[model samples]
Target: MSPYSQEVLKYLNLGIESELQAYVFYKKVMEKINDEETLEAVRKLAEDEKHHFLQLEDEYDKSVRSEMWAPYRDIMRKEGLPDIDEHISETHKELLARVDKLKTKREIFEVALELEKEAYELFAGFYEKTDDEEAKKLFQFLMNFEKGHVLTVENMLKNL
Candidate 1:
């Protein structure tokens, strides 16, 4: 039995999928970038997406079962943990295709900014719909992080 409502679980799954897709997209974009500053910025964005995916996965596991959650926490606490599975879904492959089309630093940053804005909207909607304090807090945290990413990407675009 899950602790979260089915709707909550649905949102969590959406978040998990989106974050993983973003991480892969950023990773692919990093491969095309030659400028040191842009490469570093994109790398940071990839790292942030990876972290968000982990956090959302953790929350999902906890909602589903404690036994399923403990190993993840343990692994996360350990030194030199392995990277998350990089299985690209069909949807993710489409994202990668879009990333492949990006030809300039500005194009990359513009796409990133749009992605961050969408994430912010998603989190904001989830936060508004949830009455559960824990879920609300999680959504709020994600919203703040996404908002920050949007600002960072906007600034990067301006500098490009």
Candidate 2:
């Protein structure tokens, strides 16, 4: 496998894991929210994260796995690739720990805004780093979705 393919697989794995984390975070926040409007908005965000994860996973499967990327995986295993868990941000860890303690709409919106901003940055960085046209397009799509999420969360925070 080319070094490029290996790099894309690494990015896809990070993106997939991040999306799953975001989905879980939003769902947890939803449980603490009592307002119907806020809940609906958060639910939509969670669904978007789920969709992002599926999209990234599909891309990974199509791009790498179908073409015998397993050898690369084996090499990664032999070299002991760093765990995905270690890539999670400290802010996210803190938020997950305190999710249940978020008692007000403003507080919840603040957390949501932070998460959305982080996601936007993550995708933007990915988009910037990749030279492959297909990977660039995919990352750009994710970046656009994350940008919209940031806007939505910012609006929600403003209203609170």
Candidate 3:
């Protein structure tokens, strides 16, 4: 994999980790919110995160053949490490960590918005750099997805 792909992969996983945290956080927020609209908004954001997760998984899977880690994956593995698969679900743990960092509903939204915006820029920059049609298309799709997350969170906040 090229340096560009590696960079994009890192950013994509970052977003995935954030989204997992967002999903659980937002689900908790829904419990605190009595307004139907606010609850709906939270649920929508959760769904959007789930969608983004699936998209990233599909794209990442394409890069790794036969369901095996590619060179890029190996590079991310620490030196003298057991194997990348050992940390294969690192994103899951990351999400839990982020959730542990949050103590309030507003904090969850703030962290989620920050993560989405960063992800948008990261994917958008990658989309602009690549001339590969398929890669560009995938990145663009991700860019829109992240931006949509920002909008969803903002709307939820406004409703609250």
Candidate 4:
């Protein structure tokens, strides 16, 4: 276990929320798209986000029970994990507000690329913040997953 398990757990919770936001955003985007290929890709991306959210939720539960860690709500508040819900909601809002700008399939792919890049960087930071091998492996796994997402969106943009 890392000395900063509490902080790591806080980040994991934030990641969980972020993944859910991504899933919702992608689903909404799918509604706006009529291209079969783009719709299929967006559906797949939403499914990936759902899977990531479930994985993060399981990880958080494991961390909570593993070491008799105290409830972290107050610690997270004091440490200012920066209010995950609020921060992610603002991001979601920004993405929605850009729908007009993203009328083209390529433009939508570009927005997805940006979002995946953000997730990749965030997970990499979480990996660096942890001292535990288990936590490191988990974050590394997530970082790689997000990196693949970045590549997928970038490639989609190129093809569009």
Candidate 5:
């Protein structure tokens, strides 16, 4: 892979892995989530993350055509980074190292909200830099969904 594609894949995979991990993490946290409305929102957002995982997995599978993230899986695996159900695995260990620190229900929701905001901002930055229409569309969608997530978290926090 060219250096640019490799770089894109490495960074993009980190965000992708983060999303999948959040999906799994939220599912487990949902069991202990006390706020009914927050619980329902988390459930829905968890599903959204799963769907994003599937889309990214499909993109990874097509890396042969794009060379975007082909090496990500190997690096993530050798370093013991969590790979959301294998296919959407993270290609790095730095973010994975902090995964276990989210121990409480509120922490899970708050951290997820923060992560989503970071991802949305990252994608928004890329959306402006690259002329790729497909990527722009994907990032735009992610931004909107993440914006909604922030509102959800605000409501949950207010009630708490």
Candidate 6:
């Protein structure tokens, strides 16, 4: 594989891993909670995360074989610095610690809200930094989806 494809795979795999983690986390939360409303909400979120993971997986599969992969460019503004890596798994690890301690529906929704916001920021930063049109579009799509999750979480919190 070309260096460009390798770089793309790195980011795509990170995205896939993050979504999978989110799916598992949400599913676990749904399983632990007895409140039907909260259980249903978390179940839907888990499904959404699963859907996103599949989409990214498909993208990664196609990207590895496609000619659309572009050469690496400095997406970050630092004159000679490397592209900023989205260590979403690390962020999830931190959130998972806090999530494990939550004891209420409100607390659960609050954490979900924060996680969605963080995801939106991460993707938005990538969208802004990348010069590659396709990367920018992909980042934008992820960012927008995360933004919707933020809205959904906020609505869930309000209803709680």
By lDDT rank, best first, the candidates go 1, 2, 4, 6, 5, 3
**lDDT score at residue 35, model 2, on the 0-100 scale:** 76
Error of 1 at 133 (Å): 1.1
What lDDT does the true structure give each of the candidates? 0.77, 0.73, 0.60, 0.70, 0.61, 0.66
What TM-score would you give candidate 6 relative to the actual structure?
0.71
Best by TM-score: 1
| TM-score of model 2 (CA atoms) | 0.77
Model 1, 1-160: lDDT tens digits are 7778878887887887767667767877887899898888888887788788789888898778545434334533443323434442355777777988999888888888888888889989988887778888888999999998999999998877
* Superposition error at 113 for model 4 (Å): 0.6
- Error in Å for residue 73 of model 2: 19
lDDT of 2 by residue, 76-130 (tens): 2332121223343343576578787888888887877777788878878888888
**Candidate 6 stretches greater than 4 Å from native:** 1-7, 65-97
Give the lowest summed-lDDT range of ten residues in model 5.
Answer: 74-83
List runs of model 3 lying over 4 Å from the truth.
Answer: 1-35, 66-104
Q: Candidate 5, TM-score vs. the true structure?
A: 0.64
lDDT of 5 by residue, 1-160 (tens): 4323554455456557756666666655666677687778778877777666656655545653554544443333332223344434343343444455656766776777776777677667766765656666766777787678778777776666
lDDT of 4 by residue, 1-160 (tens): 5344788888887787667667656866776899898888888887787677767766776656542212222222232121334443465676657754666787778778877888888888888887878878878998888998898898887887
Q: What is candidate 3's lDDT per residue for 92-137, written digit by digit as tens?
A: 5655466667766677678767766877887787787666677777
lDDT of 3 at 9: 64
* Clash totals, every prediction: 0, 0, 0, 0, 0, 0
Q: How far is candidate 5 from the true structure (C-alpha RMSD, Å)?
A: 6.4
Q: Which residue pairs collide in model 1, if any?
A: none
